[model samples]
Target: MFIYQKLRDSILKRQLAPGNQLVESVISDKLNVGRTPIRGAIRKLAEEGLVNVIPNRGAFVIQPTKEEIVQAYEIRMELEQLAARLAVPYMDETDYEHMQRLCDEEGETIQSSDFRAYLQVNKDFHMTYIRKCANMFLIEFAERMIDQTNIYLMLYEMVFFHTSPQTAPGAAEHRELIQIFRDRNEELAGMKVRSHIANAMKSLQIDNIQFSNLGDIF
Candidate 1:
């Protein structure tokens, strides 16, 4: 898990640029771990849609396409809305407090222009409610979908936020949704989730701006 998290954090932090190849031996030597664990961690990342392991070529960080981003968000909207609706009945005061704290943290990130931090906090905020759905399979699937979108979010961080400084992804909508959750209005909560997803999708400016080559070393 430590190896996996190290690799994952590196990718998310843009330390390992998109399309950078993950060399097992280099990573194993640097981390002082065996090649077997490195290989396993890479496979785990591939399963999470963070890495692409080709048959002959090595695993590379994912560079999501415009179409792929759109499709992922579409699926995410449905999954998350359903999650919010199902979670309304299960949410407690503690969940609301945690989510609100995430929201506050998210606001701070925007002020600091730290979009990456905002992305992580945003994920936590959504997961707070999504986990309460009480459906293990749904939670797992939703988490994967969310993780996939987050990759795109990180990939296009500058283009998504800097180009339009006014667009703060879900900063306000998240707080509003928290209130909807507190109201225990399942349908309203679902609607707010749908709207939040749509707003976030609208903020993104998708293009063929490549960040790195797959031939690049990690």
Candidate 2:
């Protein structure tokens, strides 16, 4: 479990660059763990879409293609729209307040140039209404898509740090979503969900981008 957490954090934080192989023996020596545990940890990461295990080859950090990211967001948009429709009836004052607080916190992260912190808050904002859906199957699938998008965002959205404040993403849209939810209009909520995700997906242009190799496959 410790190895899994370490490897997961490394991938999520971009400490382990995409397409880098999870070389068993090298990782074993570096983490002071054996090959068995490293293999186990890698399998876990692969299950989470953070790593790709290729048969006859080896495990590597997932280097998601632009098509993959866009497809994931398209699926996410449909699921989130459904989630918003179902979630609105269950949403209460506390959920609304929490979402607003997260939106505010996100703005602070932008000011401080704390991108990792912003990603966490952004995840919380979506999960706030998402959890209210009360459908475990939908919730699980939706969360997976969120995780994938977060990873994509982590790889791309860091560009915000060097750009103008006016160009910073999500905060305005989140505030708008918060109001839509407060209105308790499920139809409008679903429409907003579609636009919200579409806009986020549009911002990430991964075309022709190359990742630096961190390690080779054994």
Candidate 3:
């Protein structure tokens, strides 16, 4: 899990950008681990949709296409809306406070002009609430989808749009959604979640960009 998290973080932070060939030997040497563990970690990440494995070729980071982004965001929208609907009835004041703090932290990160930190915090904020939905299956499913979506955003979405400026609006939306949750308005929460996803899709336009899949790096 640690290795996978480290490698995934590197990819998400663009430290290991798309198309970078992942050499298992090199990674094992760097992390001072045996080939077996690194290989296992790679397989786990692949299952999480963070890496692509080609039969004879080596593994490589996924270079998301516009179409892939659209599909990811659409799926995220549906799943998140469902999560929010389920979460509302079970939400507590503590959860609300934690979400509020997350929003504030996100806002601060955005204002500080730290895009990487802001992105991490934004993800944290979403996960914090999404977990409260109390549906392990749904939470796990949404997490995987979100991870895939992040890969798309990190690799391709920023190429076409200025993602930094959108952070503030995204943070604001989180705040609004939290407020709706606090009010126990499941309907409004659902609507807000849908709107947030729609707005993100429109802003990112993952379906319009051109990308060529460099078939099976690994």
The residue pairs in collision within model 2 are: none
Query: Candidate 1, which segments miss by more than 4 Å at Cα?
Result: 1-48, 163-169, 208-218
TM-score to true structure, per model: 0.72, 0.79, 0.69
- The better candidate by lDDT, 1 or 3, is 1
Give the Å error, residue 147, model 2: 1.7
Candidate 1, residues 85-181: lDDT per residue as tens digits?
A: 9999999999999998987888778777787777788889989999999999889999988887877877655543453224555676788898999
Instruction: Evaluate all candidate structures by whole-model CA lDDT and list the values in order.
Output: 0.80, 0.82, 0.73
Supply candidate 3's per-residue lDDT for 60.
81
Model 1 residue 107 CA deviation (Å) reads 1.3
Q: Candidate 3 residues 1-218, lDDT tens each?
A: 78777777676555665666678877776667788888888898788677889999989877676676778888898898889888899989898898888877766665566666765776777787689898999999998877666656555444223434355567778888888998999878878988987775665543354433222211
TM-score of 2: 0.79
- Superior by lDDT: candidate 1 or candidate 2: 2
Cα RMSD (Å) per model?
A: 4.5, 3.4, 5.6
Off by over 4 Å in 2: 1-10, 13-16, 25-34, 163-167, 207-210, 215-218
Best by TM-score: 2
